[model samples]
Every structure is written in C-alpha cells, then in structure tokens.
Target: MNPLAKLDQLDLEPAAKTEVAALIQSLIEQAERDAKIIQAKDAVINAKDVKIAALTHELAYYKRIRFSTKSEALAPLQRDVFEETWNTDISAIEAEVEQLQDDQPCATVARPKRLRAGRQPLPPHLPRIEHRHEPEFCTCGQCGKDLVKIGEDISEQLDVEPAKFFVHRHIRPQYACRACETITAAPIPPAVIDGGMAAVGLLTWMLIGKFLDHLPLYRLEQIAARDGVSLSRSTLADWVGRLGVALQPLAERLAWHLRQRSSLHADETPVPQLDPGNGKTKKAYLWAYRSNDLQPGPKIIIFDYQAGRSGRHAQQFLQDWQGHLVVDDYGGYKALFAATRAHPETQYILESCIELACWAHARRKFFDLFQTSQSPVAQEALNRIAELYTNEAEGRDMTADARQRLRIEKSLPVLTNLHDWLQQTRLTAAPNSATAKAIDYSLKRWAALMRYAETGDLPIDNNPVENSIRPIALGKKNWLFAGSERAGQRAAVIQTLLGTAKLNGLDPAAWLKDTLEKLPAWPNNRIDELLPFAAPD
Candidate 1:
C-alpha cells in the first residue's frame, strides 16, 4: 500500500525504474529537511517570545520604581469608596449627636478640640528647667487693688544642649607610712578599653550615634572635629573594632537565648563588604534571628554576619538549634530543613528546625504581577491572602491556643480555596510567564505557608525579622560599605544590642551607656542581668 512500493511495481525498463526510485528518495529527503527547518524556526520564535516577556517585565519594574509608591498598600480611594461612604457616615454621626443634644434638658457641652495635630507632650522623665515669670506690679493699674496669685500656667518647650567634651583626670594621691616608709595610693577603676583615653560614656555615645543613628565613623569624626574634639576616623574605627570583640560574648548569649525559644523569626539582608585585595566591594549577608512576637519573654534580635548568602551560614549560626523558623522561601534554608528530616536521630546544625514559609513573600509575588500586569487572577490571589492577614490581625493579641482555634475557624478555609485556585490557575497560565511563576512559588510552598495555622506561636509572616532588617538597609545608604569582613561582623554585634533594645522599648543610648559601664566587671554567668530588658527600669 506504500506509494514508494507502487513505484517499484510499475512496469518499465530496469534503468527507467531505478531512475524513478532515486528521484522519489531525493524528494522525500528534501521534505524531511524542510520539516526540521520549520521546527527549528518555531523553537527560535518561542525563545524570542520568552525574551520579549522578560524584557517587558523588566521595563515595567523600572517604570514602577520611577512612578509608583514603594508601599504595597492600596491608595485610600482604591481601597474603599472613601469619598461617598466615609463622608456620609461622618455626617450621619454628627447629625445624630446634634439631635441627642437638642433633646437634652441641660445645655450642650462642647467637646474640647486639640490645639494642633502634632507632637504630644514630651515625656515627664526628661529634665526640665523652669523659668518663672511675674508681673511688674502686683496690683492692677486700673483697679488700684492688690492682686493675689491663683495658679501658674506651665508651658514646656524642649531644649537641647550641644555636645560637651571634657577630660577626666585620674589623680592618685600617695600616702607614706610614717615608720615603714611605704607608699600607698588608691587604684583606678577598670576601663572598657585598657590604656585607651575614651570613657564608657563616650564609647556608648559614639556607638549609638553610629549604629542607631546610622552615622559612619568618618561622619562621626567630622562631627567630633566640629565639637572641638579632634578624634580621627582610624581612632573611631579602632574603638568600634575593640568594642566588637568585647561585646561578642553578649551577642553570642543573645543568639543562645533566641535559639532556646520554641519559635523564632529569621531573615537576612545584603551588606556590602570592602575587599581589600580586589580593591572593590563584595556582597555579604546579615542573618537576623528573633523570638516570636507573640511569645511571652524578653524580645531579642541577633544579627550574624556572613561573607556569603549560603545555607551553611544559617546552619552554623543556628547550630543544633531546635525550633520553628519562620522565614521566606529562600532555598538556602531548604538544606537545614532537609537535614532535620533526613536524620532525625542525629543532631545536625538545625536538627529540629521547622520551616514555616512567609505568606507575605508569597503574596508579594502575586502583588508584583498584579501591579505590573493588572491581571485579575493576581488581584484575586491578593484578596484571598488579605483575608488571612485579617485573621492574623484579629488574633494578634490572643493566646496561642486561642489563635490556633481562630485560624482554623477563619483562615483555613481561605487557604484551602487559595490552594485549589492556584493549582487550577497554573494549568491555564503560560508556563514561562510571571503569573505562572508566582502561582508555582505559592503552590510549591503550600505546606510551609499553611504551617502557621497549626500553632499560634508561629507568625503568619516573617515581618518582625524583616522589620529588623530595615535599619540595616537604611544604614547601608549612609555608611555605604564595611571596611572589611571583621568590620561587618563588628557592626552586627552593635546592631544586635541596639535592635534588642528597641524591641524591649528601651532607649539605645541609655542601654548602651549602662551596659558598657558595667560590662567590664560583669561576671560571665550574670551577664543576662545586663541585657537591655533586664537593666534597671
């Protein structure tokens, strides 16, 4: 039945038959080559399409950076029908209040309005210098009568004293024994930096200025020069370096304390490090670990600096640390979780660390697509994720058991529906498109994302640690880069203490001043007493 076989069976001379067969074979070969060419062309077209999509996405991203607000929150008008509904509700409330006042037998009392919308009164703890004012005459000129003082009105305006520099002279008075001719003198107190001129107070001030205030050593040096203190940048750097070595023990203790918690949030941010050999800057990472926001204990945040963003960095920092680690879907953490699963018997770096994926990260992907593409699918995903956030908001202050029940009652259904929708949506979306990638990211981490609902101790997202990273991100813009790897590590040490102080609602300057003063003689075992939260109230 083959067309070639029919040609073979045709009656003709032997040479004519052979010629016909050769022509037919040549045509078939040409047809096969043409088909291959068409297939190759199709592949090229597909590759070009992918390239175009990527370029378009990149262009959109740059446009957003130029024109859009960085916040993911919707504008007021887009969020709700603010003009129509909010105004109507306010007017109705005012009318109702007026009607109620009209029906009252007594005169209506007007509510006191705020003088202006700005700063509240300064804290009472701040020292005040009172200035008294009195009239020139005690008696009124018009009445010619004696005036009695009733009450004094006190108005306060904040005042600042510029930086003052002074030298502390450690004068040692010697006494000679009358009979034995032996001399004795009082011993000087120990200093934070031995043989160094800087006092604990000065060191503390410099640290708070640089780390908390995000001022670099060079800038601090300039500020000091203006204040008549000619401290060089190298001198300031030396102090910071020594301080880092001295306070390293405290940072380690904080990390130990964090690991002991049942659950904690983990995150990392990029830091630029100076590569002396290359004469260029290289990227490093600051790994952040903090106790759960809902947990009842002294809140602690520790930053561990690493030269690379490798899984080994986190593993080493969290050595044998067993707890729930709430983090984003960074592949570096996967190895740690895998170790725990593969060898439950052996104590690995993160033997019992539970991986809880962040919903915020997953939602961020969809949000980016929605912002760029204005896709309905992305918007739907956002709406669903928002519901989970609402549930978390309601249960934020609740106990673990109560929050777990609340999540089950409210968030679980939404999560289930979201998962199903993402699975179906993935099939319809183009394989290489952004929408598909977003869907794939969420679906792949579905279990980890839902793990939060299992316990109230875990947060729905790793926002707390992410929030802690913001300071470093902002500081990077000012300080630019660390002088070396060691310098970066030093920054991490100070950042840990300052970050922990902020979390505990303590002033960084005050905490550092007190800690630095006592840390010199503070016993190793009682170091916890010197922590920011444990410091004198």
Candidate 2:
C-alpha cells in the first residue's frame, strides 16, 4: 500500500491529510534522487579502481626494468623498436594517475630521475671542415682603437650536408684531324643510363634517399630544390624504374643466396596499393625472407611484393627451397609445413620445410593481457618466457654446436616446466578467458616452440625479418601507397638490394653508387661480384 493512502485511515481533517501526503511524496522523491547520485559515484569509483590497477602494474614493470639485469631486459633490436612507445606509455600512465587523484588530496612524492648517459664527444673519424667567423669590426666598441687578437674559443657543432648538389662538366675536346674530319676524342664513358643527366653518384643518392631513408621522390625533389637543383618527380620516377630493372638481377642473386641457407626467417607486412578504379587503396603484402644469422654466409634479405597475402606468394617464393622457416602463426604459412601441406599429390618431390613457431608471438599475447588486466597468470607466463630468452642471450655469440649444447642443457628444462605449467593452467582457466587463449596458443604450437632448443642454428623468434620490415613499415607514412602493382614490385627490388647492403654493414649509398658505376658495363657472368654482399675493391 502507498504511504500516502495510509492517511485515509488516520483520524485527521481533510486539509491536514492532504498536507501530510504532500510532505511524504516530496521526501520519497528526494531519496530516489540521492540513490541515483550515489550509484553514479560508485560507477566512477569502479572505473578509477580498474585504471589504478593497470597504472600500478605499469609502474611496477618500469621499476623491474630499472633494476633488472641486462639479460632479463628486451633485446637491443626490440628495445630500438619499442623505446619511443615505452616512453609515451609512461607519460600517458602518469597523466591518467594524476587525473584520477585530482579530487583527493594526497602527499606528493618526487621520483628520482633515471640515470642516462651524458652526451659524449662527436665521432672522431668524421672529417672536420673548418669555418671561420669574424666580427664585423676588429676594433673595440668603447675604445676607438684596434683590438689585438689573443686567442680564439672554438666549439664544434654537428652539421650535415643535406643533398648538396654539384656539377661534373665532361668536356670532350675535338681532335684537329682535318683529314678524317672525325671529331674523335675519348668515347663518352660508359654510363648506367646513357644520355641521362643523372650521374651514378646522383642516382645513388636518390636511390638511398628514396628506399633506405624512406623519403618519397617528391620529398627528394624538394630536398634537391633546396640545394638549387631541380629534379622533376617524373624524372625521378623514370630513374627509379630503370634502376629497378638494372638491379633486378642482383636482387635475384641475393634471393638465390638466401634460399641456399638451411634455415630462414620469413615474415610479411601489409602495404597500401592505389586502386585507380575505386579511387582508394587496396592491401598488398611485402614478404620478407631473411637468411639465418647462424649460417656461415653473407646476411641476405629479399622482399617479394605481391598483390595479396595468399599462401601461394610464399609457396612461390620458396619453391624448391627447403629449410627451417621461422614465422608467426599466420594461416597463409600453414600450407608450407609438411603436416599441413595443401598439395600432397604434386608430381615432383618437394623439399621438406620444417615450421618453427616464434616464441615472441606466443609471449606477446600474455604481455598484452598483463598490460590491460594485470592478470597474475599472464605475468607468470611472461616471467617463464623471459627465462628462455635469458638463456638464449647467454649463448648468442657461441658457435652453432655450442649454442645447441647450451640450449639442451639449460633451456630444455625451462621449456619442459613451461609446457607443463601451460597445460595445467589451461585446464583450470575459463574457456573464454584471455589466459586460456594464451595458454592454448603455446600448447598448440608446443613442438615448434621447443624446436629452437633442439638446434642452435634455428632462431628463437622471427625477429630478424621483422626488424627488416620495420623500416618499410615506417616508410609507408611518407610514401603513402604504391601507384600500381608494378611500382610496388619495383620498390621491393630496390629495397631488397639496399636492405641487403645494410645487412652487410656497408654504406648503402656508397655501395649503390659504386654498383651503379660498374653495373652498366659489368659482365652478366660475373654479376654476383657486384652484389651488395661483395667487398668493395
């Protein structure tokens, strides 16, 4: 029954009852409003609690990183790839914590600044070019008398020559052989592209700027213009197209060498290709295959740009080549493994390819879970994975046999424990939970994950090729998309050569310039001599 209805039963006058009912209604409405406000406050508090937990976990991670041994930290390559994001994450977390605590007054504690290496002297080997600066007047301003020079204080500033342009004037004097009336001086020197205005050096600069430096041709044009040189975009495009054709042989040779390795790393990154018909872009793939670092040979990386990410692209690239291939759990590579071989009745006997799963991929799932939810299960998984990496680091520089022995002795035990833990954890974890998914991922690929421990030549992860793809991923921001499929393939050719050059520790620009100079006249029979891996004469 309504409380207001109870007034009817009370012994009171009509007006008195009406007044009492109004007061009761007002109080009830006020109580309802108060309940809603409290509910909202509770919701806000819940959100803050979740946010605080994530931030606290992040802070603890940073603290561990600060005090942890070098072997326990991320590898150098991974550090280089993630350093910027880590810094940004730290700042974002601090801001969020400050916002959450703004309403509450608390004692503030100052954090110690992280110790960092101070700026050291500039490289001593770089040639120093001197520039003298003199005052407008040699006389003192106050005293109208000439000032005597005592000494000069000099400080060095790091400087760069941004696309400095110069001209090479080739003057062929006409011979005064009136009898023959033949103006025969030295025949024009052999050129990479005869009659082209760009010298091999200039061509090299443009190639390096475009591919290695990740600058687009238009940007290269703007850079050249800054140096009072006018290089049209079309001309650059023309040069690039011709260079791709010229360097295709070298890229092919590098790919051949890459296949010779018994172990390899394969990975891919998506690239945007312009779709002229739709007035938009379509997805393309740049498949990167890198030779094993443990193998005794030059480091080779080949990029094969294709229209799509179908498994055929990889199959075609690795046709007749067989080795241990390290890759992520992408479905496209499923056909490459013998157990999952899509074509079992092929006429020719295909070489066997052993599939190796990347531990980093498996660990990344738990890493992300820990980051977002601070799950203790995920944290434990990460700790176990870290132990495996620590062992790998200890034997990083050892010979293949030694590394294999070290892994069997030190890493196999950890792997055994991790596998057992994963299996046990998965049984108890909820089927739909993130922890279960992470555990299942490792369990499904347990054999491949542990295979690296069985061989020293196999990498623990597909980081080598992934690291090579990083530059291309970064380049996509500037270049945007390839104009056509052909353009993308051409880009792959150039990137393969330049990337291979970088892997060999050669200055890409210098190697490219020398190669361009020799390529036009170099014999095809001896073409391998001009590859990026070859030592300069």
Best by lDDT: 2
**After superposing candidate 1, which stretches have Cα over 4 Å from the reference?**
1-115, 341-351, 535-537
Identify the leading candidate in terms of TM-score. Answer: 1
The TM-score measured for candidate 2 stands at 0.74
Candidate 2 lDDT over 42-144, as tens digits, reads: 7777777667677868976865664453532465545655666666677777776776767433313223243568778999988999989888898999997
lDDT of model 1, residue 48: 50
- Give per-residue CA lDDT, model 1, range 1-537, as digits (tens): 655799867888889988988888899899999999989866765655554455445545544443454456554333343335544554454444444445443422442222346778898988988798999999988998999888999888988987777888889999999999999999878778988999887898799889998998888888889888899988988898899898899888888888889888888888989888999999998899889888879999999999999999998988877778888878899887887434568644445677899888898999899889899999999899999999988998898899999999999999999899899899999989999999999888888898888777788888888878877877888899987888888889889988999999988888888788888888998988877784444
Q: In model 2, which runs have C-alpha deviations exceeding 4 angstroms? A: 1-118, 130-155, 176-183, 339-351, 534-537
Model 1 clash pairs are none
Please give the RMSD of candidate 1 to the true structure: 27.9
Candidate 1 local Cα displacement, residue 518, angstroms:
1.6
For all candidates in order, the CA lDDT equals 0.82, 0.85
lDDT of 1: 0.82
Ten contiguous residues with the weakest lDDT in model 2? 104-113
